[model samples]
Target: MSTFKAPKGTFDLIPPYSATYLAVRDAISGPLRRSGYGYVETPGFEDVNLFARGVGESTDIVTKEMYTLTTKGGSELALRPEGTASVLRAALEASLHKQGNLPVKLWYSGSYYRYERPQKGRYRHFSQVGAEAIGAEDPALDAELIILADQAYRSLGLRNFRILLNSLGDKECRPVYREVLQGFLRGLDLDEETRRRIEINPLRVLDDKRAEVQKQLVGAPSLADHLCDACKAYHSEVRALLTAAGVAFEDDEKLVRGLDYYTRTTFEFVHDGLGSQSAVGGGGRYDGLSEMIGGPALPSVGWALGVDRTVLALEAEGIELDIPPATSVFAVPLGEEARRVLFGLVTELRKAGVATDFGYGAKSLKSHMKNAHRSGARYALVAGERDLAEGLVQLKDMETGEQEPIALDRVVEELRAKSA
Candidate 1:
């Protein structure tokens, strides 16, 4: 019989590489943590209609990509395909909006599921670090989210990413642009599905990547041209704030992101290094998303950075993260008596805040030393029966191939001083 394997389109994160993924997540969430964004977590799966209504029935995420299931109790649920909608739902359910704070800033990191055809940077199961600022309508809030994301990428030493900014006018003006865009899209030589999308969400047609479809969109109307006075000023203020903060961005009038909830400010972080899956992260203001999901009119903005794609981008640029070793010291005890003594020392060292590992399974000295070397430890504490009898342990510096005898009572103090 064949051994089991991970399901198709999904992959596991293991070992040394998982460390890099963790570092990327920490880097992305660092700015949010410092800027009053509290950590928030939601269920891996949520009520199906939460997404269906919040993310919009017309978008691909809700219609094609979501992983859904029916419970034995006859309730429908879906593994969260993205972070924003679920986060908003959680915030509203808990009445975070009712609190004195107008905007409930939050940060989250976790895996999201989507039934997409997996590729290098895209996966059926993927990880993201996301931030949300709920219950605010100020343009500065929009700019703040964008600036924080920029700071995160820079903190990771990434320089090849570009920010694409756009404005999807809110209720008052977007309808006018939608009508004009629809009229233009209707006349295009497109397939049946493309035609259907034009009527449902014409802006999404602008996001279509096919060369044939793009060719006919050459003279398509620009949303920037139809922005109402209020929307134009709001978008302009967002641009000014980003510029004042020295965050560079390009105005991409056609960037209507994949989500149907976004309105007013929309921005995407794209890296040229990642080929077709260039978008490492993106988000925008979803001013009406709260109402769409049956909550109060709470304007919000947020972004989710793809951890898997960010790691890929790091490789593309040939950058390595400086991750310290997990184990700083390895303890190898020889003989049963030495094992008991050294185990006590190991516990004491660990309590002293030293990262220590031990040689388990009573391995030979040679095997234990080899394991110590593989652990990336800076020092190894090797104690045999003879050394213990002398009230001593052999301290071996893994780096310089040097060894010295230290009094057993002073082991912890000596190691701490050496490490310092």
Candidate 2:
């Protein structure tokens, strides 16, 4: 083996497992594709200020987890820690909002970078499938995204995951709740850093996972209770729409996502199977994010499902996707003349949409057959100089051990028919 290794917290997705990875990503993106969410991509890194301004400088994602770099030109850049802010930046830069198509829907699948202690279902570099609907504030849009994600997970045969829902009241009333929460936090026995967070962003204190901090927050004021009439009506409409669509969710009063821009409706998808990392994916309505990032005032909502976490959830439930093998036909040539003939036939079969593979160089028939079997091929094609002289090839069923001779010209049609 090479002396070098993959970076400390990254991994290489080789074959067999890579197939499942792609399947997981596709399973999540498929429903969004059918729902009119066009695909979009952005640079892996962006100006550091973009995230600091959009994701909140006080949040852990921006302050502690972001991978920042100072370029030779002295420009501060950072590897994206999440998908939403980058997508919104791309949408605004392209002026998609000015086109008059309200709520420009888009989907994206890619790798994200962050600095954190790696654990089960959590990694420094991870993959996610995300969707965004920009420039609309309707409750139906929010419900549609939640339902679409639910349908995607169900399509993959997953049943044990739960949706945790909450509403982080908008600008009109969130400040009032923040002050009340801060007053309560200050009276509790807490660390200086915890107190500092209450000053910069009191909502983050509710998301703390520390047992001591949580115990002190048992009777803390709730944003759900402090929402103004407008915010409360908006939250009620979102809940009603989700109920009408048959999606089940639990009301989580403390579900303030790690981001600062979320407003009104917020949610997270959790699977009890995952130990500490229970959240497989979640997103909320970030109505103020555009103005925070220096874009037009656009109300938007979206969600991103974690491909890695979803795969882990599938393993925990022991669900296997019925994915087909990469190769259906394996070709083995016995002699020099047979090699030329079989190679040509292999090329023809592949061009005709057949999944095929072949053994290279002269080898014993037994070795070639072993390779064919290990490849998970459905059928094996064998040809020798003698068989070629008669314009025939021996086709053997890998599963049944049945063998028969077919004319050279008929092999392609025979295999195509069987594959179909």
Candidate 3:
């Protein structure tokens, strides 16, 4: 019989590395938590139409990458490929908007699924830490989200990532610019799919990474030039706020993120260290998303930072996170009576806030000590029948190779002080 394995294109997060992933998530979410953003969690799957209407019908995420299914009840659902739409749906469904809070500030962390060809940073299943501020259209809100994301990366000691900002022009002017861009794109020698995208969404063509498509896009009309007066002022305020906060960014004229709902402001964080999959995270002002998903006109701004991509970026920069050892003390019992006594002490130590682990099923002292060393514990507690009879246990400092006998009754107090 063959052994089972994780599905292709998906990988499991195990110990050591999983610890770093957790630290990265905490670092990214720390600032948001301090800034009045409350934590939220939603299901892994949502109504299929929610994404189709919110993420855009022309984008690859909806048309190609989404993992969808139909239930026995005939309801179509999809594993959420992105965070914003589902989050907005949840807030609206819960009547959070009607609770007297104009902008419902929320942060979420979870796994999102996509059926793309998995690469180093791109996976079938990926984790992200996302933030959303709904029901507000203020430029400061946009700037705040961007600044927080910047602070998060900096707190992680990441220095090479760059922020790319752009204004996608709200409902008023975007249509005019779309027509002009479509006219130009239609003239280029392109495939049928590219030509079709020109009609549905010309902005996505500008985001096309293909060398041929990019070459043709050199003379395309810039969205910056087509912004309406209102959008121009809104984008200018967001830019000024970011600059004032010392959050540097580049004004990319073609940064129409691959979402249909984004309006006025869009930004992405890219790291040069990662080869092709360089976008560690990005989001924008989806002012019409709430309405698109059957909710009221709750304008919003949000960003989702890729936990997996950020970890890869840390590795590319040769940066190792300072993660403490999981086990601070390993208990090794020499005999049956010693096991009972040591186990009791281990429980006591744990209750006193010490990270303690016991050497289970190891018979010999040498074997138990070896297991203790493998646990990455700083100290080891060894107690035998004779030692317990004398009301003492040997405390061995794993780092210094020093051992001393302590009163068995005072084991918990002694270890707590040492750990502190």
**lDDT for every model?**
0.94, 0.94, 0.93
Model 3 over residues 142-250: C-alpha lDDT tens digits?
9999999999999999999999999999899999999998888989999999888988988899999999889988888888888899999999999999999999999
At residue 395, candidate 1 shows an lDDT of: 96
Residue-level error in angstroms, candidate 2, position 138:
0.8
Across residues 1-420, which tens digit of lDDT does each residue of candidate 2 receive?
999998878888999888998999889999999999999999999999999999999999998899999999999999999999999999999999999879899999999999999888889999999999999999889999999999999999999999999999888899899888889888988899888998999889899999988998999987878999998998899899999989999999999999999998999999999999999999999999999999989999999999999999999899999889999999999988888899999999999999999988778999999999989999999999889889899999999999999999999999999999
lDDT string, candidate 1, 1-420, tens digits? 659999989898898889999999999999999999999999999999999998888899988999999999999999999999989988999999998788999999999999999899999999999999999899999999999999999998999999999999989999999999998988989999889888888999999999999899998999999999999999999999999999999999889999889999999999999999999999999999999989989999999999999999999999999999999899999999999999999999999989999999968999999999999999999999999999999999999999999999999998888767
Provide the lowest-lDDT 10-residue window in model 1.
411-420
What clash count goes with each model?
Answer: 0, 0, 0
lDDT of 1 at 191: 97
Among all windows of 10 consecutive residues in model 3, the one with the lowest summed lDDT is: 1-10
Clashing pairs in 2: none
What's the TM for model 3?
Answer: 0.98
Deviation from native of the Cα of residue 156 in model 3, angstroms: 1.1
